[model samples]
Each structure stands twice: as C-alpha cells, then as structure tokens.
Target: MTEASGDVRLTGISKTYGSFTAVHPLDLTVPQGSFYALLGASGCGKTTTLRMIAGLEEPSSGTVCLGEQDVTALPPYKRPVNTVFQSYALFPHLDIFENVAFGLRRRGIKSVKKQVGDMLDLVQLGEQARKKPHQLSGGQQQRVAVARALINHPKVLLLDEPLGALDLKLRRQMQLELKRIQTEVGITFVHVTHDQEEAMTMADTVAVMNGGRVEQQGAPAELYENPRTTFVANFLGTSNFIAAEVDSVSGDDVVLRAGDGKLLLPKARCGAATSPGGKVLLGVRPEKITLTHADDAGTVPDGRNRITGRVVASSFIGVSTQYVIERPLCDAFEVYAQNIERDTRLTPGADVVLHWNPAHTFGLDAGQDVQAGVEKVEEDA
Candidate 1:
C-alpha cells in the first residue's frame, strides 16, 4: 500500500435526493488507520455522509479522496473500500470459510487459502470455518461478515450499524472485537451508528452529526468533557444546565449571576457570552457534582458553586444514586453521586446543597433551546 493508502478525505461533499438535502456541504478528513465514527439520530444524515464516502451514493457536489487519489466519481466496486451492513449478508448455503473466500475468488484471485485463513483467525473464527450462517450465533455470523470484508485488504472499511442486531451482551462483546480487529489490521475504519455508547467505546475520533451538519468532531472524551453546543452537551451525556446572566468578565474568569447566587466559571470553558451582561447557560455534568445537606452549606469550601435545593426524586441504581434536584435556576438539575458512603440524608423532599469546582462548569448560548437533545416521548391522548 502507498503511504497515503488509508486516509479518506471529503472536501465540500454533500448529497441531496430530489428536493430534500440529505447532507449539507461539509469537509472532513479521516486520518490513516484511525477508527472514526459518524454518530447521530435517524434522519440526521450520518448514514448519507458515510455512503457518499463509500461511493454508494454520489455526492451532489464536492470531492471524495482516498489517499492522494480523487475517487469522487468512482463506483462502489471501483473504490478501494469495503462496507459491512447491519445484516451480515452472508449466503445461507455458504460456510464460513467459503463466505470469507468469496470476495477473493470473485476478483479472479486464485490460491486464497492463506489469505482466508488469516482473516478467519483475525476475527477469532478459525475453529468455526465449517459452520454455515444459520448454524452460528449472531456474534459469530457478524465475525464472518467482518472477515469477508477484511480479506480483500481494502484501504478503508465502513461499518453501518454492524452490531445493531445483536443482543446487548453480544453487541458489547463485538464492539471490543471490532476495535481489536481494526487495530490489528491497521486500516482506516469509518463507522456509522446512532448508539452513543458504541461510538464512544469503539472509535478513536467521533463526529457528532445533526441536521445535515457536523456539530462537533473530536476525541470522545474531549467532546464529552467540554461540549460547545447545547445539542452536544445533552447528546453525548447527561448535563444539568443552569440559566444565568453574565455579571463580570475579567481575564480568564467570568462570573455568572443566577437567581440569588453567583457562579464563577472559567472563560475558556464558556461557550458564549464572554462579555458581561450577556445571557448564558452554565453547564455541569451529573457525575461532576457533589451533593450535601442544605444545613451543611456553610461547611462547603470556597472556589465551588454552592446552591441549596430540594431533592425532588432519586433512584438508587446500584453503582450510583441519581437525583433530580429542583432549584430556582432550573426546574430539574440532575446529579449522580457514587454510593461510596451512601449518604442516607439525600432522599425525596430532603433539602440539599449541590457544589462542584468552578473548573468543572461550562457555558453555552442561552438563545438556543434549553432542551436540545432531550428525547421526545409521545403522550397518549
């Protein structure tokens, strides 16, 4: 393979079907041999974007480049890429060995024994070579699909919700398996999925897509820790946003004034309203907050935002206790505290104080919808 073999780049690429635009003009580059994931909900254009890169759907405009070659107008078979769909798509009559070897045989390549054997071993299915798709479990069948795709030695591999059909336990197992296979082969893999956890677990880089555009793209931990948009703040994980107005901005520190309390936030963490007197939303992750009794508010140390509220509800979920605290800044502020000591004082209707370091807080533009990523549940009439 050439030095640029595994890199995939899309420059101003977009797709539209009839009057509807599936993907807006966007530019993205997937680094060589990196595991990348396109994440979003249904109709968010993630799959459409992936298809454009794979040559399955022609882009309305822009160029698709693999390595140094412009493969924008190339067909799926002409591009040096392979795809694994949600369905394994293996022939029922073909055994595992034949299925994996089929790709090589179709390309008129003879003597595929070593190549087929190596791929099967890579996916940990060497012993199951003789089994048909129907005879194997979902996980095993999925592995066969992977082996078939990898046997061709494509520069890039695209997975479209390949593990969506498996049960939760098997799905989790395959996630690790896929990551391991990608690392072993050293091929660029672009994965498309709506599952946030799957993207976080398997990909080295994740691009969060919405409304035909990428909202943000970065390392999973980076995006989760410091989300710039309201959608990202709520989509990747649970975030409790407190409405506040800017009171003062000095150097790297910006003070926010909530109802009767003051929140000191780092300017670098503020997504908007860097100047004073502007409206903004202060954000903190559920796990980053510490809960204390309302009576103990005075005992809390300085440099942390301390606010008293009543616990509206709480669920003891084995690993941690999740609480919904009703406060003046927001109707419901979620908090997750580990059951290390199992504070019995925190109960429904109990008064408590929520405190966390100023550095842990972030800010977002208040003009955007407060509940951008909340799942909408239909109520029965």
Candidate 2:
C-alpha cells in the first residue's frame, strides 16, 4: 500500500466476537488532516472498524499505525485518538467547562482552566461554560463532547454516528459545523455514518463498506459518477439497472441490447471482454432519464437507448416530478424530470417514453454478487 504523510494505516485488520466476524481483513489508509467517512448500513462493520481505530476494540489480527506509531495494542486513553460517540457521552453532573476540562485534568495538566476556556471558545461554547449538560440543548451537549475530546489534542478524532441523535434540521446544521471545525483545527477526523448524504456533504473522502469490508473508496463525486460496482451504484442513490447483452465493442464504448429490446450505448470504457452474446448490466441514474408523451413525434432524440413504458405512478416533489414507469421487459424504472415550470406531469395510467443520454449510462459485469445482509432500510410510508 502507498503510504501518505500523516496517514493512519490499517493492514489486514480483523475483529471477531466468539465465532462471529465483525470486521474482515481490512486495509485502509486515512490521509492526515482529511475528513474521511466510513459509510455503510448497520451491521456492515463500519462501527467495528471505527472502534478498532479508536483503540476501543483490538483487532483479532494485523496492525494499526498512527502516523509513524504502531498503537495496535494500546488502550483507548493511551492511543493518540479520542472518540465522540452517538450519545455525546458527557458528564451530566459537570458544567460545560468542567466537562471539557475532564480529559486535561485526568492527565494532570497544569493551568487546566486556560485550556478549557480556549477549547470552549473553539467550539463557540464559551458563553455556556457554566451550563450543565442537562441545561444545554442536544446540539450544545454535542459541542461539549467535541470540546472534551479535542482538549487532549489527539492526532485523530473518531466520531461514531455522533449526529444520529439529532433531528433532521439540527443534524444538517451540525454537519456543516463539524466540517468547519475540522478545517480550523486541522485534525484528522474519521467519522462513521450510514447516511450517504451526510458522508458526501461533510467528508473529503468516503469509504463505502459492506459485509465486513470496504467495497469502494473515493471522493463523493467519483463514487457517484463512476461507481466501480453495482452495490456502490445502488447504495449511493436511485439507479435503474437493466440487464443487457453486448452486441459489439467500438474502442471504449460498447453497444449493448437491453432485456427490453432497447439498444444501450454506455459511456464507460471497460476492460471486460464483450462477445456478441455476452451479458452485461447498464446503470442509469433516475435523474438522467427523460419522459415524453407516447404520441410526441419529435426526432426520436438520436439517443442510443430508448424504451416505451406506461406511467405507473407520478409524484410532484416541488422542483422535480418523480415517475415510476413500467417497462415491457425490465422491472419498473424510475425517472425524475425537472419541473421547469412546464406542466409535464403524466397521469398514472398514461403511456410514456423513457430516453436517456448514452453518456450517462454505465456498464458493468452482470453476475457480480449483491451484498445481501447490509441492505439499507427504507423509511415507513
């Protein structure tokens, strides 16, 4: 593995509880001072990996290195890492200043008052220094917890779903706050979250984990635009995956036939062999698809892929219209059209045509195994 400056390296790291494997052999490198996120659904080993890096849990095998130090066997307090847990984990009996000062006091640091004051000011909690944990709101209590962790000047700050307990508005606010704090302090932050939007918005890099291992790691846009695996494409956002067979290959672009008798030309350049009848998968984002009335006699749009379907459902979402269209050969495909002030909402039973730019289509191998146990849960209707 390539070693970057100020990087935290984990090589062949694994964790087990009795007979159950919590984290499979994992290799990861978090560059120094970068906001990195470990993202996955619950039980996907993201939390376990964060704990291992925080020194709260030891690896069953392999090594953990911080910068130039090997701290695999070090205890939480002994390692140069501090954690802000989901619950804030503040001391209820102590005021903001005292709680933030707790870590420094434990280390017998002199002039603890000045250090606490500085840390409190750092988090904009200087005026609330006298307030107890119960006297503060959820967001305030979270800031106190952050202050407490940072007072010790740890090299890496591990946050395990720290914003999970807040409401949507507060969570969004804190996400920006957390990113700003990281920038001002220039400390490495390794955050664990199952929220794709949260990870994409706050972290400099994202590692998508699944089934006890990281499936893909890259910048948010990189993962969103050029997903390496079907799991990454599906997990990051809404996508329409259509089964296809490669008809021909021209340099990087491959012409494939969708299961529904529609020809698809993908934008991706793949190394996979494409024989005349070889099968593949075509992935297109919901937002990339355009819906038109079935009888519209436009120029067929000169697209490499087009399919006719019946609109099964349509919902207005203020700025966009989401349509669920039933295709003849593939599963129901979803498309989102921008409102643009034109009344384009189709009736539920109306016939429609779905067309998308070939540049938006991506091709991948057809037979990759889907990660089954870590699927994200949809909100109740």
Candidate 3:
C-alpha cells in the first residue's frame, strides 16, 4: 500500500443480500479535497454504499480504493477514514476536550494537551471544552463529534446524514458550516444524505441514486438546470410537464405543438430525439413561469411560450404566490409568481395565461412516466 492521496475511487462497487440487491455495480470517484454527496430516498442504497466505503458493510463485489491503495479487506480501524454519523456517539463520561483526544490517547500518544486544545478551537468549541456531551446542545454536541472525527486527521471523512437529527433551520445553518469546515480542512468528504436541500446546499458534486442504481450525478445547479430524466426533474424539485408534438424543426429551434398553442424549444435543451410529429414532454419549473389574469393576457410579452388556463387554486407562501391552473392535456399546471404586483382577480374560477421564456423550457422523451419522481421525496422527507 502507498501513502493515501486522499481520493476515494470505487470501481464496479456493489452490495447484495441473499436475493435482493442494495447497490448495483457502479463506478464513482471522489476527488481529493472535494465534498461529494450520495443522495437518495430511504432504502435507495445510499446508506449501504456509504457503509461499504467505511468497511462497516462488505461489498458483494468490486474493491474500495483510497487513493492508489486498495483497502478492500482492511477493517474499519485500519482505513484512513473517519465517519460522523447522525448519532454523535460521544462518550458521556468525558468532557468535550477528552472526547476529541480519545483517538490520540488510544494510539498511546502520551501528550495530548496541545492537540486536544487545537481541535476544540478548530471546531469553535474551545469555550465548551469542560462541558459533558449530555450537557451540550444538539448542535454543539454534533460539532464535538465532528471535532473528534477530525482530530484523527484522516485522509477522508465520511458523513452519514450527520444533519438528520437537526431541525430544518439548524440543518440549513449546519450545511454552510460543514461546507466552510471542508474548505478549511481540504480533504475528501463523502456525505450520504436523503435530504435533497442538504445535498444541494453543501456538496460540490451529488450522485442521485434510486432503486439500487445511480440515475445521475453532477453539480447541484447542473442537475437542476438540465436533468435528463423525469425522475431527476421531479425529485430535485417540482416540474410541470406538458405533452406536445413536434411541429417542425426550425433554425436552431424545435417547433412544438402543445394542445392548441405552438411552443418553441431550444434544440440543445431537448433531451429527446425529435422528428416531425414525434411526441415529447415539455417541462418547465413552476418558478420560471409568469401567471397573468386573462383580462390582462394581452400584456404578456411576445417570443414567450404561452398557455391558456383557468385558476384552480392559489396559495401565498411568504416570498411568492403559487397558483394551480387547469389547462388542456395537463390539469394541474403550477406557476410560482413573485409577489411583485398583486393581482386580486387571479383566483379560483378566474381565467389566466401562463407564459415563460422559451429558453427556459426543456424537452423530454414522452415515453417516460411523467410522475416518476412526483411525491417520491415525501417518503423520506
């Protein structure tokens, strides 16, 4: 074995039981000094994959590589990785300082004063050094767990839903703090999570797994903007898909006939093969659409993909108002309009027009189940 270079490489890694498969054979790479997330719903094999890398769960096939060293047969203690789980697992009898110094003391390092002090300060828990684990707040205790894990200075840190125990607000705050810590420490951080927002806000790269397979992997923004599958579009966020047929192929644009209206889609944005009369699904995020009262429909700008519908419901959600419109082909056409101008007439039983820039629309293969990811996150959220 060579010195660990801090990169985690998995080639054809898989996990299986007697008859059921947890993680299918897949290849993944976590570059040195990067934050990577494996995101998926419960029972989606994300946890199994993380455990395999930690040596807690053995892979049915393939090898686990830490940099150039293959540590497939090594025990968890021998691998150059420390895992921070949802449970802090701190020793209740020890103070914060001693808790972080436990790893060093176990290794027979006699003098642990400077090392423990520095670790506490690194995690901003220097002031809480004398406090016991049971006495600290949930967030503070979590920090102690992280400090303890980092004190070992492992080549990689594996986090398994470390923010699961935190409330929504605290979880969000921790997301930024973890990202800050990762940047400061500059080591490979492989995080496994079911929360889409947590993964999006923290990880530099995210691999979305489903049904024992990795559906897609990319930057959060990249995945959000150009999802190749309906499952990805709906799972990451909400997407309103409109059924359409290719009217013709114009210069750099694909003319689509959606219901009674003609829509234009960018050639590059279409993720499906297009031919004259071929069916496709035109997808647009709710926030990308502008909803206007039918009485004021004429004011909508030109060169925009437009749809005529009736307001079925409306909701005010603090920053923006979400409207559900009933339209041809698709009944629940959703739109999120910023609270810029109040339109009192845009209510249930009111006529409305939904419009958005054509460039914001993406075309998907019509054969895919449009509801593939709809409500799937609710299972774990």
In order of appearance, the predictions have TM-scores of: 0.98, 0.92, 0.96
Could you say which candidate leads in lDDT? 1
TM-score of 2: 0.92
What CA RMSD would candidate 3 show? Answer: 2.1
Ordered from best to worst TM-score, the candidate numbers read 1, 3, 2
Per residue, candidate 1 scores C-alpha lDDT tens digits across 1-381 of 876778999999998889999899999999999999999989999999888888888899999999999999889999999999999899999999999999999999999999998889999989999988999999999999999998888999999999999999999999999999999999999999999999999999999998999999999999998898989888898889888999998668899999988998999998896777899988999999999998778888988888889999999899999999998778699999998998788999999999999989999999988788766788999
Q: Which whole-number lDDT from 0 to 100 does residue 236 have in model 1?
A: 95
How does each model score on lDDT? 0.92, 0.84, 0.91
Full candidate order by lDDT, most accurate first: 1, 3, 2
Clashing pairs in 3: none
**Per-candidate clash tally:** 0, 0, 0
Question: Which should have the higher TM-score, number 1 or number 2?
Answer: 1
lDDT of 2 by residue, 28-133 (tens): 9999999999999889899999988888788999999998889898887788888999999888888888899888888888679888988888889899999889
Clashes of 2: 0
lDDT of 3 by residue, 221-273 (tens): 99998889998998899999989999999998999998778999999999987
TM-score of 3: 0.96
